[model samples]
Target: MLLKEPRLNFTDVMNRKAQEKGIQLDNDQQRLIRHLETLAETLLRRRAAFAGLYLWGQPGRGKSFIVDSFFAALPLAQKKRAHFHTFFRELHQQLNGQGLDAALLELMGEARLLCFDEFHLHDIGDAMLVKRLIALAIARNVALIFTSNYPPRALLANPLYHDRFVPSIALIERHMTVMALNGPRDYRQQATGHGVFSEGAYLWPASAARRQALGLPDASGAVALTVGHRTLHAASSPGEFLHFTFAGLCEAPTAVMDYLALCEGHERWFLDGVPPLARVSPAAQQRFINLVDVLYDQQRRLFIAAACPLTELVAGVEQEDIARTASRLSQLTTE
Candidate 1:
């Protein structure tokens, strides 16, 4: 997808790229983009400015792309950016050695600008940690940017610990502008001419045979080994790793649920079909989402084969629960 289009407004960048054509932003979106741009410009102008801005929308609404472009345009030395998982992982590591307060203050103090891609507060663990981190960052005058599927008010939606989020919600409202970017179509639907690759599903010859045939490891970086009755292939890099045609990979003596159980251990997968679940029932879709979520938590790299790219996956599925699954899918790929 072509992400560089001067004519496309910031909010519509992903949708535009998905089409490889332009999609105009609605008035509110245009205003939101302008506001975001102004914030970016302000940060550029002032060396020390700390604030938080939350950008929320359904999946494939272009939140991450906008943030990516915004930072790409800035000088690298002034920015500290990371995906939500990576940020927390690094923070936890730092905290172990330096203590939470010191680590939090040091990072907040050093970063003139920091962005958390796919900022989520759906769980109590994140809600508590984030509450402390935000407080420290705001006190230190650090600028922040985040993208989420939930509005600030709706974050930490877990009802069990919902009361704990009042302070976090209040902190966000007091410190940042919350905006929504909704569009008529999923930008992912425009991928009419692109191709995606996954190495996991490819059939390869035996180790000695591959050594003689291709003179290299197939794709998994292993001497070809068969798992169950299926052959696992190798790839040069983690991203180019394994992929499977949805039908072929899922068909086995074991039931669908059993095949899903097999995928739990894998951290990187490329699925190249409509995921039979989608064509079946709502219960199936929930299971599929669970499959997707498990892969995501393993920090797995996923490559989905579709008629469209990431955006269309959400566009094609109109069910509210399914759409939320689509959003979950989108979060793993970007930000």
Candidate 2:
């Protein structure tokens, strides 16, 4: 027997849940809800008015909450929702294993709808790959809905590689119902929610006394561990924690793929010696941002020791996604 999803408007379902959690949908969020409701109707009625939906905005805008609610209420039997980076990580492996068309077909299976959160493109290589992903989904008429911090115009935004993604941008514009929930409230920064991610801790000016009192593994005991082809030193505590220095983890040429691979093996992660973003090089800042995104997506517990408070550290950074990093970091409760 196919289970029936309640026929509530996406707004009612989202608002009721949000209220219980002390999150009220602002005007912009509600506007997006109305749009989502329309999309849901289109899907429910078997109408192909749009191939997908894209919601883009700054961090903490409750994009995840809203989209999850909509997805949960969806009656479709074949649907999948994933964090963008996490999905791409798997997609890359699959593409390497089974060529382009075969990989997508295997991934898509019988899914009628796919929802991706934290959709973004910081590298041109990923952008080119995603371009194919989007194009294939369109050709097969697989619906894709995305929640991103970057607008379509801003994706693959490196000036040197921007032109390469125009076709993907055109595909998105023509096929998807792109909505902006650039709301005033960044619900993530509020620090009131509870989750595996929320139970994590943050320490400012992580003094020696602080690390000791928190029972964190000493960085002095860091042993060299191989990640992919590179050897990085991190303190391993039993099977629970893997600790690294910011310089060793982010300052080096560690890739997001490394973080994804490492995170699967370790449940708890700690990073020490994080200087304020204003003091760090742009490349290092981006690495840190990518690290946080991976951790947040994996819902792994993270402990961060920084030279200064997160507020001061994130201030003066020009990275567009830094706000997202800060917003996610904001969810960390003080230890």
- Which candidate tops TM-score? 2
Worst 10-residue lDDT window, candidate 2: 232-241
Provide the TM-score for each candidate, comma-separated: 0.61, 0.92
Predicted candidate 2 versus true structure: per-residue lDDT over 1-335, tens digit per residue: 97664354887787788778876678888887888887777677666434688888888777787888888898777789888888877788897757877886788788878899899897897887788878878777677899998889999788899998888899898888878877677676664764787777898867789878767887667577777777777755435568888887888888888899888788788888788878878999999999999999898888898888878989999988988898889888775
lDDT of each: 0.57, 0.82
For candidate 1, write residues 154-231 as lDDT tens digits. 786657887889888998988887888777656543323112212212112123443334232223333333555555
- Where does model 1 exceed 4 Å of error? 1-21, 47-49, 106-109, 192-324, 327-335
Clashes of each: 16, 2
